[model samples]
Target: MVNKVTVESLTYEQLAKVFDHAILKPEQTTQDVITGCELAKKYDAKSVCVKPCDVKQASDLLSGSRVLVGTVISFPHGNSPTAAKIAEALQTVADGAIELDVVLNIGHLKSGRVQACQDEIKAVIDACHAKNPDVVFKIIFENAYLTKEEIVQACQLSVAAGAHFVKTSTGFASSGATLDDIALMRANVPDHIEVKASGGIKTLDQVVDLLNQGATRCGSSGTDKILDEFKQRRGL
Candidate 1:
């Protein structure tokens, strides 16, 4: 388990390491992606989560930096056919994305087709691992559309599928990550699997609160503002 540290005591680097700076909006332009990568590099963020099409460019821009390039598979909807999602995962890895945040098939899970959902996730994980064994895979739950019990089941499936993390939302959902959800995910998953709180996280306090609740990473577009607030509070 990660040692708990007060928000005020965290250094800028420590705070930055938990962020996966997001650039996944549909309206985001190439320049926006470039700017986002710059911000990720500047902040030394853990990764820059970009749209699938932008993976190659993002990887090039982030070359020589510690920031990893990530992209979404099956994206916000998560309703894509399993074969399609697996193909997308392979293509993204070939495009230089070292991390993938894949949306779970919400429809299948909601319908109690747990085996199908787990199989789909496992397929993508296997494909990615075959190409690059170190590729990080985060399974997005889109918690706004799931019940507490469903969330627990999703976490279990994620671990069974060999996913590296269980994420909260897609940021397009009606709601995003909550402390309660993060805590629930933490309790359910094994120590090898981490929790990532994404969406609706705009403030430093919100990020810190999620971390306190056992979120190891976060996906946010407001990376600049949040880090600035951290710097201000810490007198950096």
Candidate 2:
């Protein structure tokens, strides 16, 4: 878990580390991935959240840098079969990804199949750990498709399944992370399990606001803009 400090007290590097610069758009190409990794290194962001196919390339590019490589599983939708998700997770870890952002099985969760959802999440995390126990796992809730009660359910299920973090959105959904949802997620989970606010988080103030509200991480594609604004604010 990150240190519990006010956002105002965070220095420029501390603020930059709160962001997981997203490179997961489907239309993005290899060049985009390269550019994204460069941006992550430039700002010393936490990680570059890339698509599954770009995991190896991203890992290679980010190797020896403070920015780690993170990839998504089952992507915007969490409807993939359990076997496939596990396979994808293992492969990404093997390709040198140290962090993973996996989408929860939203359909199963909403259909009241809590046990199945938990089982799948645990199974995926287990497989990844079997390969490398240090690989971090963040469960993406894609909150746009879920109700408040369901979101809480997702948070509980993620914790029960041993997820390291519970995330807000995939950014491909109709809506993205909201302050209300971030606070709600933070309130629902124990302190050990962190909350990540993603999707449409584009400004430094929004990042600061989310951090203040208990989000340990925020995902965005506009990392350069946010970090540049931070430098301007601090006159770095």
Candidate 3:
């Protein structure tokens, strides 16, 4: 495939745009969220993905900066009730988060409850859109848990439900984002929607490889170290 390690494909400019550092945890304090947002600003990252408890702090810190505030809903597990997921998304947004990553109900999708899965996504999307048209909604399908056909189906459902992006994993599942998954997601999704590759993206090469596979956004805590490595290699 494409060699994305250089400044050519995933350029310094583009590299900065791909980051969405995940700072989701109970032990993480407001200061941690603020520092994460600051780091995003310093590195030119797109956003800092925080948990619900820290969304407000992240939003406040990132307000005047280009770094956006993102929060996860129904989190690492897609087994939560649809109502719970909806409430999480709504409350997180009301808490000042501009971006949301909601886990799709894998049970529904895999059990051939196609309409149920679609409806859940649509309801959440509708709720977010109604709250504020500018709010971004990304649906996480946890690709590692799915077969190839299931992955394609998930992408189609995400697009049909009006999600802004189809994300790979929550980093707490059987697997995280993979090149094969990204390729499948990119090829299956419509051009209007973007692909997000997350989970276990620790090195610079992983980021480059994912981007080359059509991942427009990346979620990881390794952003700073990875970028540092890139800059050092470039003698910048």
Candidate 4:
């Protein structure tokens, strides 16, 4: 974990490491993905979170770099069958994705299918681990569509399922990551299970604020703007 407890104490490199440069939009073209990968490389981002189809390309582009490749499973909607989700997790890993952000079954959770939800998450993570033990797994709660209690429940489910992180929002929802949501998620999960703030994170301030509030990662498409602002703020 990052030892820099406060945002002011964080260096430019540390701030860059907190970002997972996102390129997950459905309409993004192949060229857009290439440009996004270049941006991630330029910023030394921790990872490039791309769509499933783009996983191989991203992995290939970032092969010699430290920027890892990550892809989403079940995506904006978490309504896929457990078997399909597991297949996607396996395929993405095979395509060189080192991290997987899986969307939780929002309907199941809201409808009180707690055991089913936890079971699916466990099955997917277990299968992915079987393929690659070092592949990181994150559970997306899509908090914009859930109640506070539901968010807490999702956190518990993620922990029970042994997820490495609990994420907020999918960026296709009505709203995205909020400070209140980050704080709430931080309080609900254990120290080992970190929080990730995604969806609508566009500025350096938002990034720093979320990290200070306990989010170890922030997903954003605005890598250039955020990192440029960081340099400007410090006159670098």
Candidate 5:
């Protein structure tokens, strides 16, 4: 079992590394993306997960910052055809996104089409790596639609397909990441395969709780508030 990380014991840098700083709402304007990048730069977050269309602009704005640019593939829904997802992955990377949070084909997984799911993931991985071998790929399970056994299988497939992380949600799901689901993902994947918990994670305590449960990263739109709360609570 992974050892828990207490919030009070964490450094500011460690706390910063845990956030992806989501900016992916459908109605987010260009100004919103710019403001989001500014927040990411100010916090020195791990990345700013934006919509595919914002990849280029976000990358340009965050050019000299430590914050990497991330975009989604198949997005809130995982129903995009394999070829289309592959194409989207390629274009996003070319547009300058170095990290990708891909939604798994939930329909396929729920239908017990495990191989198909794995193949699709592999294809996207191949496409991303073809452009930048160092690109990070995090597979989104959207756990609200999955059973415990299905979650295990999805984790297995993600690892087998050479994904860098297994994410818990898209933030557009019926529910977001839970401590139980985070634990399940951590237990199933190897240490090298990181876990990213997203969706409904707004407060500092929630992020810390998920991290203690073995989440390596989190997706949240409230990066500034969360960090401020962390500092306030810690007297930093």
Candidate 6:
């Protein structure tokens, strides 16, 4: 669905339709997460994604609001073990995160440890589900490390492993989400799955472009700037 964004305040109907939104910083203090929630609440954002370390505070600040708490697991490198990743996801959720982003096993996947990578993803998903069956699972593939073929294969694998979304990057890779990567994921994912275009999505135009390419969500720290543009554009 094309995001019908305007400068006016967002609604539950509108927020559910929102896929692109803000992520908190690791260096930011608890006050920052509170501030982020206040700002996101003003727009009724779908979620305020923060690093795992901040999930507890963000969740507390955003409690009673419609916004969900998002946290990343395993992160950009994907060198962490399946057990460690599951543990991280468990900790994140226990800390009040409702949406989990797990990094795919890139080294394993690239080295033809296909089943290993798939099993890792599945384990994370299962563990997260066990904790909170309602928790949403986004599997980051760090797409810049992949070729087009790898991106497609990863998308299929993510779907097969029961991930809710196929994410592009951790925003720490050499490159972030690309139209090509989102397009590939959109094309390859099963009907039940979604695509989240993360990393390096700084501008409103870039976010719109990602949505056009079938990105259902976006993770970025530049959300304030984007909202500013939206306000300016709509003269609200």
Name the runs in model 6 displaced over 4 angstroms.
2-24
Q: Which regions of candidate 1 fall more than 4 Å away from where they truly are? A: 1-4
lDDT of the structure predicted as candidate 2: 0.91
- Cα lDDT tens digits for candidate 4, 50-88: 999999999998889989999999998999999999998
Better of 4 and 5 by TM-score: 5
Shift of residue 80 alpha carbon in model 5, Å: 0.7
Q: Residue 133, candidate 1: how far off, in angstroms?
A: 0.4
Q: Report how far residue 24 has shifted in candidate 5, in Å.
A: 0.6
Stretches of candidate 3 off by over 4 Å are 1-5, 8-10
Model 4, runs deviating above 4 Å: 1-7
Which 10 residues in a row give candidate 6 its minimum summed lDDT? 6-15
CA deviation > 4 Å runs, candidate 5: 1-3
Show the colliding residue pairs in model 2. none
Candidate 2 per-residue lDDT over residues 12-93, each given as its tens digit: 8888888899998778999999999998998899999999899999999988999989999998899999999999999999
**Distance from true location, Cα of 32 in model 4, Å:** 1.1
Clashing pairs in 5: none
Tell me how candidate 5 scores on lDDT. 0.93
Q: In candidate 4, what residue range of length 10 has the lowest lDDT sum?
A: 1-10
How far is each candidate from the true structure, as Cα RMSD in Å?
1.0, 1.7, 1.9, 1.5, 1.0, 2.8
Predictions in order: lDDT:
0.93, 0.91, 0.85, 0.92, 0.93, 0.79
Model 1, residue 165: C-alpha shift (Å):
0.2
> Tens digits of per-residue lDDT for model 5 on 52-141?
999999989999889999999999899999999999999999999999999999989999999999999999998778778999999999
TM-score (C-alpha) between model 5 and the true structure: 0.98
Clashes of each: 0, 0, 0, 0, 0, 0
Candidate 6, 1-236: lDDT as tens digits: 55554334443344234543555455777777778878777766778888788888888888898788888887758888777888888999999998888888898888877778888888888887887899988888998888888888888788888889989998887999999888888999876788898888878778777777888788876666676676667565
lDDT of 3 at 99: 88
TM-score of each: 0.98, 0.96, 0.94, 0.97, 0.98, 0.90
Q: Rate residue 44 of model 4 by lDDT.
A: 96
The TM-score of candidate 2 is 0.96
